[model samples]
Target: MVSTVFYVFIFLLALLSYIFIKRNNREPHKRLKLPPGSMGWPYIGETLKLYSQDPNSFFAAKQKRYGEIFKTHILGCKCIMLASPEAAKFVLVTQAHLFKPTYPKSKERLIGPSALFFHQGDYHIRLRKLVQGSLSLVAIRNLVSDIQAIAVSASDSWVSGQIISTFHEMKRYSFEVGILAIFGHLEERYREELKKNYSIVDRGYNSFPTNIPGTPYKKALLARKRLSKILSEIISERKEKRLLEKDLLGCLLNSKDEKGQVLTDEQLADNIIGVLFAAQDTTASVMTWIVKYLHDHPKLLEAVKAEQKEIGKFNDLNNLPLSWTQTRKMPVSYKVVLESLRMASIISFTFREAVDDVEYKGYLIPKGWKVMPLFRNIHHNPEFFTDPQKFDPSRFEVPPKPNTFMPFGSGVHACPGNELAKLEILTMVHHLVTKFRWEVVGSESGIQYGPFPVPQEGLPARFWRESSS
Candidate 1:
């Protein structure tokens, strides 16, 4: 009878334990709430609302209503938008491991799956180090003269009185600079081939991803395949020559994993294309905005011009190229670059996917939800800048509060080509202010978003080379 009583006691205890465990598991779900915002229509879920108006307005409206951390569904994914510096830091830096970088499958296909930004952990670290090393201040400083020469050549093309799309021209110039960084100096035929095919890819980058024949995306896919063939031939020749150069291509060719495995040729090509894509549009957009901003703010433009022309006069007297040292010391132009990056905010936000259920300030970000750190919103916030909408470079006389200025982004996945980009911008600015004069050809003062915010119709303008007196 005692044994039977003990058996009954054990069974009852086990039953109670199971119930207790289940209730505790359910309790957190009961208590944790999703951030507050509308999910919008069923599967479509606010996608139309986002694309229907200025994206900035959409995000700003959301922030105004729901505060910094809020929930919304767009592009068919539920997302948590973080606009505050602390929130951005939490997602991008301190707690980055919990959020993996995410991109659409279509984009990955075009840019290549192995490109640096699409990765995490060791693979990302390895690629980033290689890219950063190749574009480091040490490496790029050597290319100052080469970049200046390219800037001069490009500026020579803009002297025609005919209206020119500043952004389009800047894209060409930045692409040339990108080519220089990647391959040192490429053959003209190869350069032309790349320019031809890359133009197709650029046109289709934001197009609807469909396999329908004759569509822009289809042409882009074909061009991408052709680009691979061209890259393969280039790689074969480099191997035949047994060269040990230090350009980005060389760095990729010579990289080895801990296991002594080299990156595949396909991987090499993806990153090459990725670097070109990275270097071109955003830099072009920012440079174009600088042109517009300088035109719009006469006093700031005159100040920048004065600074650049002084450097020009010195270079002319010494018969010396614009040295890297000179580029570093352009306080006025540098401030303008900083202000343009802030006001334009070309890379408005970046996307990361939650790897697990994560909590931020009592809000639950469920696994697989998209998390966006809205850099543009933070940039335009009045708390951070006195007159957020004004094109005032003087505001940059003092350094911005930490985490508030992330024009190049922050954390591990931040852009590796940023230094090269700034160099190109500064070089271009030096050439423009000292050698050329331009006038906006039309009265249109609106902005257009061809993925990045650019002035209307690429800021059509007429250029005239400043005559030597």
Candidate 2:
């Protein structure tokens, strides 16, 4: 027994030595002279610090301690955090070819490779063109009535004085709009399934990688399977019908590349799911923030109401013919939407991997190292926006220097749905302001950030008919 115990201790020591040697041998960035940051310890690196309760604060602190560019390790990989507009433009716009979207192994497992968000080079360009053209001004203008009608219907369900979660409501609203815009008057049951599939995909993002029973990843996989099944059925149905509706799905179905080849059913389904996932979360979060901001600042609400009143009655929304010229004329409403997005940036950090060795500001960026463009830092920079913490939309009236404000990101991979997102936000805000007057319920109400930051406590607001009624 003594000999066995001694041998066990020896084995333990040997393992520790091996691990120490391996860690010591890990490539060092001595040649790069990159900016300073806390690397923490092995495996976890700065992940714990980087993902602390207040990631924004943590990032800000790091920037304060170590200028604009900083280096850190996360999940055992080297990463560089770019905060300043100069670095942002250099990395995102000027040197875009060297940087590629980077996702964790777990995320890839959930979202799949066929999704447009993950595609690169020519494929991504083609997919983006097809999707963007389908959601063009003409296409979205046609769906405006549908969107307005849905908004009215959704508002009808809200009860005065009853506590309701605006975040969830916005999710449902965006989901419905996306469905109508993408699928166009599909069966009610089919639409419900689309909502379910999105929820599954979202939940999957928060799950651990384990695919065992009861795991979130496992459930997400099941959800993906269900979503794929429905998509397959829809594709098969479309094929059989051969009637083109000219909606997004229809466009994809009818579109062919230069080689006369069309996107396969699976490819189409993945793209659809990708768009839904992207559109739903960001839009819902933005809407929720808009509501929260309006509730928090009653003066802003009044301004919005005045703008709506200038346009006419709430009921006239569907009937009132609106053109791109008219839409851009709502400057206050536009600024409010822009400010909300800037304040409650739904996506804080966009990750990219170095596709090849590159140099920026005399620092070596080795191939495969992860790069993070910390937009939150840029947005809140005092140098760019005076009193950045204050919720003021007017600041945007005189736009900040380019690349300083990228709520939807910058460069080629910038969100294609930016225009549609803006239109939807303005429409929703216009309707809400004209329809009802709401005030924040309690002092406890506040915004929260995580994956997609929104109202911490749902921004429960007590609603009453406006005095103008």
Candidate 3:
């Protein structure tokens, strides 16, 4: 009986030894087998070069050398650039469940940690649905008149002979619309104060992510703190009054998640700032580009004018606001905006992280590695859009392939404010084209696209109303 017990103990010891040996002998996570590319220097690998003076040229050169999906370290993460429609769809749609939206440390810090822009998974879906419910068609339709008034008011401020920076003008116009639509009307001083603060925040997104004294990032944080205090005051006043209104702030105050929990005061503040920044910066950038492009191509300008004239025929262009249906029906306007979005590529690249070690198109994307959808490269790919660099709005007359035109990205993580952005763009064009005739004063200094697309000189131009001229 003692011998039997000893033999059993010996057998258990042997099994344990074998298990430990196997673990020690196993390979290290298959060595990743990442796509072909250099990792550059230890840290800050290719980050400066990627965001250099001519980032677009750098990307184009890299793409020419290394096919679509190639690995490189950028923005403190080892990432792969997905520059083809197939890759975009694969990462953003077909196998989307395996990827989650991500942003660089800089973006997250500037946009706020709790902003809806950073939410992922079920929370993201819930947030998007709640916001979408508030930004309903009827709500947007109601905003058209106000948007038009702001656009026209700003456009009128451009004296006939004065050489104004179209970029600056568009920025003021878009920001004002956002302010009014979100915070309600206020004195000009308050409007300018908000604009100044938001501008600081916007500039920080493009600046290097440093928080030392006098750094843009530091100033931005300070501005954010001030802005937060301002918003908190507004929220306090609104809560005390218990006054229900229809603007963005009001809708958000009443917003509730799928679980019926209302957004916290801080969450609501972050989103309000985020929405305003997104609306003002991107919409203004695109509209400014459209003006430059249209001035460059007169034939297309005339085509757009014709479309606007037709739309105006249904209602007095001077007094009556454009109906929602009329704005969507403007094909020429739609094509023009699409072409601008493609050419300018306001959002050059967006971030996604692999949920696991993913094998896509025979290449391994290791878990936690970022997959950057190269929107600008795909928009300029000749295979997808013929003569991709040329500003031909007609290319959009017939829609491109599924994932070919991704100005707003694709799949579940696409920009939730895309439709609202479109509405804002259309409104700007409708009002500007109908009200004024403008000409470019200086040749467009090519786009500067580090964080967002904007002309180097801000597209200085001369504009005058038809009646005034």
Using lDDT as the measure, which candidate wins? Answer: 1
Tens-digit per-residue lDDT, 1-469, candidate 3: 9999999999999999998777666634454477888788899898888776588787788788888989888778999888899999998898988988787777776667777768777767766675665566766777777777887788877866989988889888888877876767755766677778888888877787787989998999888887887777778888898978877788888777668988787787788887887777778889999988888888988899889977776677456678787887998889899999999998888888998878877778888999988999999999998998799888977878888889887887677677778888899898888778888876666776635778877888898776622
Relative to the true structure, candidate 2 has a C-alpha RMSD (angstroms) of 8.9
Decide which is better by lDDT, 1 or 2. 1
For all candidates in order, the CA lDDT equals 0.93, 0.80, 0.81
TM-score pick, better of 1 and 3: 1
Model 2 segments beyond 4 Å from truth?
Answer: 1-31, 314-325, 443-446, 465-468
**Predicted structure 2: clash tally:** 0
Clashes of each: 0, 0, 0
How much is the lDDT of residue 15 in candidate 1? Answer: 97
Supply candidate 3's per-residue lDDT for 214: 95
Ranking by lDDT: 1, 3, 2
Error of 1 at 323 (Å): 0.6
Model 2, residue 20: displacement in angstroms? 31
